[model samples]
Target: MTSFQMPNSADQINLREWLDEQSRQLGFDGLRITDTHLGDASERLNQWLAEGRHGQMEYMARHAQLRSDPGLLVPGTVRVICVTMNYLSPVIDFDQEWQRLAEPTHAVVSMYARGRDYHKVMRNRLQEFALLIEKQIGSFGYRVFTDSAPLMEVELARKAGLGWRGKHTLLLNRESGSTFFLGEILVDVPLPIDQEEESHCGTCQSCIDICPTQAITAPYQLDARRCISYLTIENPDAIPVEFRRAIGNRVYGCDDCQLICPWNKFAQRTALPDFAERHGLGRASLLQLWSWTEDEFEKRHEGSAIRRIGYQRWRRNLAVAMGNALADEAVSEVDKDELREVLRNALPTSDEMVVEHIEWALDS
Candidate 1:
C-alpha cells in the first residue's frame, strides 16, 4: 500500500467536502464515509453461513472474517468512503415490468443486467475516484472495491448513511430507493464519518410478502437457496424443481420484492449511460432469447454480466422460464406448440443439464 501524509483536521474537513463534489461530478449518486468496524453484521453473517443459507456461494464463507474487518482485508485501512450509483435507466417503466411479468411468453431479465456489466462500470469509476483523491492528497494507502470483494458492502453503505437495509436485504435510500450499485474505497486516512440512517421500513413487510419463492424468510433474513437471483445466477447446478414454477418467466433475476416496495416508486433514473438497456433485452420474448445460438449468446453478451453465467446456465434458466410459459393457460396452443418444437429441436444437442431442463419444459 502507498502511504501519504494526513491532512490536518481543518484541511480534512475541506477534503471531505471536495470528495462529495468530485464524486457527484464523476456520476456517483451518493457518497459517505464510515470506519472499518462491521459490528454485529459480522455475527449475523456467521450465523447465516452456519445455517448454509448462502447456498453454493462458497466464497461468502471462505472470506467471512476478512469481510467483517476491512483493516484485515487491507491493512492500515481506517475509513471507508462508500459511494452509490443509481442503475435504473430512465426508459424502464415499473408498470411495463409488471405487464411483462404477466405475459408468459416474454422473458424478464433483471433490469440491472439489461445494460453494461455494472462490475466493470462501477470498478472503473471507483478507480478514477480513488486516483482523483490520490492526486488531491498525494499518494495514499487505498484500495477500491465494488461487488468484486467479499466485504459486507450493504452494511458498510448503511453504516455510512447511504441507506437503510430493507426487508429484502438490499440497501434502500429515501431518494434513490434500492435501485443502485455500491462501491467503496478503503483508505488509511481517518476521515470524518457519516451517521447511520435509521430504518424506515417500520412494520412494512411488502418485500417479504411479494417474494415468489419466500426467499426473504423474515425481515432482513434471506435464504439464498430459495432466491430466484441465486437460483439463476449463483447456483451453478440444475435448479431445484420446487422453485421452478415460482420462477415464472424470469430468466436472469426476479425483481418482485423491489417492485412491491413502496419506496421504489421514488427510484431515480441513472445519470450515466452505462446502465442503458442493450440488445432489446427489456422487451425480448422467451422465444426470441431461446433462439440465440451459443455463439450468439456469447457475442451479444460479450461485455455483459449475463455472459459470466455461461451458455449452460443461461440455457437452463431459459428452459425453466419457457416451461412456465408452456404451462400458462394464457398462452395459445400455437405458441405452446412452437415452444415445444423449439425444445425438441434443441434436445439432440444440449448438454446434460440443459437437456434435462428442456425435457422438463417439454413436459409442461
Candidate 2:
C-alpha cells in the first residue's frame, strides 16, 4: 500500500500536458487518461468467455472479474493512464509482408515478436513514466502494467482515446494504425479523462475477409480458437489438423488481419532499437527455423517474446508450416525432399506431441 500527496487543482490541470510531453520524450507514441468504468466491455468479455472464444487461455476466465474492474486488481485505482508505443520497425514494408506470406517456404513470424519482448520493454518504460509522475507531484499511489496483469488493456486504451477498436478488434489510430503495444498506469489521482474515439471502420470487412482461418467471426469480434496467433503461441497441445493447412508457413503469431487492413498504410515505424528485427525473423524460411536445435532456439530467442512459447511449441509450429510447404505445388521438389528428411531425422528424439506433428509433416 502507498500514500498520495494530492496535487493542487491547477497542478492537476497542467499534469496532463506535462505527461503528454514527457511520454513523447520517453518514446511513447501516444498517451491518454480515462476513468475506470468498463461496463459494456466487461459484459462483452464475459459473453466472449462464455462462448469459449478464448480457447486454451484459461487465465481469461479465471481473472474475469479483475479484468472487468481495474480497481479490483489494484486497490485505490481511479484513473488509467494508457500509453501506446509503435512496434512496427522501419524495415517492414506491407508489400514485402504480403510477398513473404505468398511464399510457401518462407516463415512469417508476427511483426511484433520479431524484436525484443515487449512485455519487458514496455513495462520498464511504464515504470519510468510512473516514477516521473511521482517526482512531479510527490508520493503517489499507482501501479504500472503492460499486458502483465489480467486487466483489459485494449479496452482501457480505447476508452483513453489512444485509438478506436478496428473491425479486427485491435486498437487503430489514424496516425499509427494498429502496430503498437499498449501499457497503462493505474493511479488514485483523478486525471482528466480523454473522450473515446468514434469507430472509423464504417464497412471495412477486409480483416475478416483476409483471415486465413476465418478467425474474425464478425466486425469487432474474434474467435481465438481459430486464430493462428492462438494456435501457434497459446495452445499447448497439438495444432489441430483442420487449421494446419490454413496456418501455412506462419511459425509464430499471425499478422494477416493487420497486413490486409487499409488503415495500416499509415502505420508508423518505431524509432526504438529495442524493436529492431532480431535473428532475421522477419525473413527466415521454414527450413532455416526448422534447423534450430532446442539449445539454438533458447540461445537465439533470448530476451525475445517468442522464447516464452518454449522449444516444444516452437517445433510444433515449425513442423506444421513445413507440412504446409510440402503440400504446396509452388515449393520446389528439392526443398520438399529436404523438409521430409528433416522431419524423419527428428522422429526418434522428439517428444510424443512433436513427433506427431513431425510425422504429419512427413505424410504431407
Tens-place lDDT per residue, model 2, 231-341, is 999999999999999999899999989998889889999999999999999999888998999999999999999999999999999999999899999999998899899
**Where does candidate 2 have its weakest 10-residue lDDT segment?**
1-10
> Per-prediction RMSD in angstroms?
1.1, 1.3
Candidate 1 per-residue lDDT, tens place, 1-364, comes to 5566667889888988999999999999999999988889999999999999999999999999999899999999999999999999899999999999999999999999999999999899899999998898777888899999878999999999999999899999999899999999999987789999999998999999999999999899999999999999999999999999999999998899988899999999997888899999999999999899999999999889999999999999999999999999999999999999999999989999999999998888
Q: Candidate 1 regions off by >4 Å?
A: 1-9
Residue-pair clashes per prediction, in order, are 0, 0
Using lDDT as the measure, the top candidate is 1
List the pairs of residues colliding in candidate 1: none
lDDT of 2: 0.92
- Residue 305's lDDT within candidate 1 is 97
Q: After superposition, how far is residue 245 of candidate 1 from its true place, in Å?
A: 0.3
Q: Estimate each model's TM-score.
A: 0.98, 0.98
